[model samples]
Target: MTETNPTKVQLVQVDPELEGQRIDNFLRTFLKGVPKSLIYRVLRKGEVRVNKKRVKPDYKLQAHDEVRIPPVKVAEPQELPSVKLNKVANLEQYILFEDDQLIAINKPSGMAVHGGSGLSFGVIEALRALRPEQKFLELVHRLDRDTSGCLLVAKRRSALKSLHEQLREKQVDKRYHALVSGHWPASRNKVKAALRKNILKSGERMVSVAEDGKESETRYRVLQSFEQATLVEAFPVTGRTHQIRVHCQYAGHCIGGDDKYNDEVFNLAMQEKGLHRLFLHAYSLSFMHPKTGERQTLIAPLDPQLSQVLKNLSHA
Candidate 1:
């Protein structure tokens, strides 16, 4: 469907490319420039219809379903990210794997996965800028702003849907490496706790163990031990927000350089050993390929700074 008279209603038919997509999500693309509040307003007022019937925002559009889009003023196009920026241009060098359906990148720390919340652009925005002609690109999963690891991006809607199903089925495996200091017992290989997230008025998010919170579990294996720090591989059984960071804190071995959920004394001690950021990294991800149906395992090596901190501790 192409742009029509802004004052006129447009009837666009759904295609297989957007099959199974929610009505509200489809409208954002269809009615680009329309405010989100207005999109919901039209839906709530029954101005937007599917198959000549009123549908809720969550209605899944099907092939050939006609959508009645009410005329709404489109805003001026937002400025696109400049591809020449070093952060955007250099992303290609970080690509660990790529295929027809998806890509795997060893995301750098301190960069948000997707733009928003005061960030003008992020990895996804940069990727989109890099491939202007690519029709569809979306994140298969997200990594925290400070946690670097294997992040997935789908090239097609089908691929995104497939990978999401695999994740829901627990068929995806992700392993992370974290550097912490304290008495880490080999016998305490796993942490099973419930966590609750709290939002401070300052807009900061914090997660802590709470008996009435969501159940979480993480299995750990010691990689190396040192008087200053301990390196361990953590496998999260359930994907919860900040599960690994909070779990490490609960175990009394808070990850070094963790500004949140960290022990101040331990952080100061770790800083002396050259650890300056959250000492957490996602090392690998294993999953069945959405397009090929074959098992795929992707690995990301520790970055130079992180690797150097480990070396620094060895000699400290």
Candidate 2:
């Protein structure tokens, strides 16, 4: 009967209402804000202790079992449960933070996280090439190849597993900066809708609001208002595919330069202002350290291109 969202470790003695449910799915519903993969990781790692012992992801709950659920960190995407600024348009190495457990880089726009779909190499591939001495490197979560900002790479499987669990439970805090068409209302603060994903015959992925889709939400705070555009901070409360972008569109404000979901006239105006890429940037990521259990925040400085666009808008 526990109903409110859990913000820290939890110990729930099973009852008749909770029995017979699979642990993973049960965690999915209990920690409704988290990603699935991270939930699975914690199960595999025994982070979710049942009666002080580990259980399988498929383990069925019993009425007497005592469940120990760990605290979660939240950061999400339509997918970032998951970059930076400046200098020579991303030619310079943008290492925001690095430790033995993970690497945070200021990912440039137009670079895939991993190679596939006619790409020979991407960021993960390039990092592997640069760090031959390291034996393990993997993305903890993902960002759109077109979106530029902080992306994390785990140095060890243990770290990956730890971060994944944290991500699933919404323990990581993620923030994005975006420029959207038209003036945004000060009273409008959130978008709540169901999102469905579709793949076109051309293999392009598209997401839209549909009744049968998964529940999704994105919270917005207007940062600055322009005559024809608004700059806002986006927080994806529920990670559905392209949740933030679609939420904006559902609210009648398409982000500038979004190729798939865009306003042609609005985009043209943005293009004239030198916005050739998506105007969304994952500017900041705050999360708990997998190793130390302390919280950390990584800041990705805006690249010169994005900075210039803001400048141009301000002057105009």
Candidate 3:
């Protein structure tokens, strides 16, 4: 794990592995135990500087750029509890691809990506424990906690930078398999709506379609239709929080087993059919190798339980 000296103002030079990382994310790692709100506050107040100039939270750091961090008290690092190690060992079996620059895993549903918000450990934390020798592992992108599928992790900083560029330019192709309530209209192949994110009083996050929200788009192709549900492929053109699930709801077909944006009666029906989790899986991803520029595509087959649900629906 990376460590920073917090007892005094320190100037650290960015390395190749951290190139193109957002300054705010970089600070979070450098200043472990500091709250995210404080990190943003520091950025807003110009207390954190890059090359002696204040930069926004989204400013990407370049190699050799000097970052000045002010002195701040951080909590003492805690030792990893023993039970977490056992959970991490299970992830070894899900590795779909691994190379010098990156690793791709078929992340399981119900597992958060990185620990926070009461989760003691997530995929990234477990991976870190599993590979203590790795110095620069980081998440390239994210998947919803209940959505299982192909997930990318960068082994080097340069690779992370390259992949971020691809995502920003929409050069990478991601596809998901989803089971939703109701019969989807054959002609309704695309959904374009603006989404705005909100936080409830309890700090829970939600998203809804709004006129003053960010533009979001999802392309849907019905793979199969049943009396009460439809199996479809979802291609999200813009990545927003809960984009696919919310858009499907907007189409009057909320994803099955989605408690946040789903119909309760429909969920009960899907549960009776053996659906135990959200029926959204990131089935495939296509992108250029950040190191070689060679195109690579990875696929994660549906979990057997999810497959069984589809079979049950098809036969019904």
Using lDDT, give the best candidate's number. 3
For candidate 3, what is the lDDT?
A: 0.91
Candidate 2 C-alpha lDDT tens digits along 78-104: 221111222222423777888899999
What local distance difference test score does each model get? Answer: 0.90, 0.83, 0.91
TM-score against truth, every candidate: 0.91, 0.72, 0.84
Q: Write the per-residue lDDT of candidate 3 for residues 18-56, one digit (tens) a residue.
A: 777899999998887888998999899999999999999
Question: Lowest lDDT 10-mer window, candidate 2?
Answer: 77-86
**Reference-based TM-score, model 1:** 0.91
RMSD of 1: 3.0
Q: For model 2, state the Cα shift of residue 99 in Å.
A: 1.0
lDDT of 1 by residue, 265-301 (tens): 9899888877778889999999999888999999999
- Relative to the true structure, candidate 3 reaches a TM of 0.84
Scanning candidate 1 in windows of ten residues, the lowest lDDT window is: 1-10
